[model samples]
Target: MKIVKEALAGTLESSDLMVRVAPSPEGALDVVINSEVMRQFGAQIEKVVRETLERLSVTEGLIVIEDKGALDCAIRARVQTAILRAVENPVLEWSALS
Candidate 1:
């Protein structure tokens, strides 16, 4: 339930989000979010990303996303990016784009 280095480095607004990418027993991801977006968006962010992940066929691990005002699209992108980045790759050498 920790994001580690998943976000765009400094782009992470708050530490409210927690993303986990463990291997799924169903050979797919299981995404779950502790969302409070309803107060902000008048809707639940979980259904948003859950549907998106299912539509995108992201079936792997129990992704527990803690939300704090991140939009649906942003949530999806961040989660997907985190998962992809978690996969095989060399050490990502990044510099400030600011």
Candidate 2:
């Protein structure tokens, strides 16, 4: 899924995470994450984000995640929502997402 425009999901509230996705002309996946538990769970969070992107077939974009102690499932949901919003297309392959 190509990010055609900027999109955001989630909030800054506790136990939630905010994700921002945007298009990138550079043809690379650029991810920036800010989390309170970066020291211990940063790598794991990055891995989750990468895997989510791969699952959605998102190869090139800029992703910024602001985590407020969110679990892995929440992070994945927010990322998926943000990507869907970024694409702005109603005809999504829902089966592929499963």
lDDT leader: 2
Clashes of 1: 4
Deviation of model 1 at 39, angstroms: 6.4
Q: List the residue pairs that clash in candidate 2.
A: none
After superposing candidate 1, which stretches have Cα over 4 Å from the reference? 1-18, 25-29, 38-43, 89-98
Question: What lDDT does the true structure give each of the candidates?
Answer: 0.52, 0.92
- The per-prediction tally of clashing pairs is 4, 0
Q: lDDT per residue, candidate 1, 21-77, as tens digits?
A: 555555555666565555665355777666655544455565666666676566666
Pairs that clash in candidate 1: 28-59, 28-60, 29-59, 29-60
Candidate 2 residue-wise lDDT, 1-98, digit = tens: 88999999999999999999999989999999999999999999999999999989899999999999999999989999999999857356776565
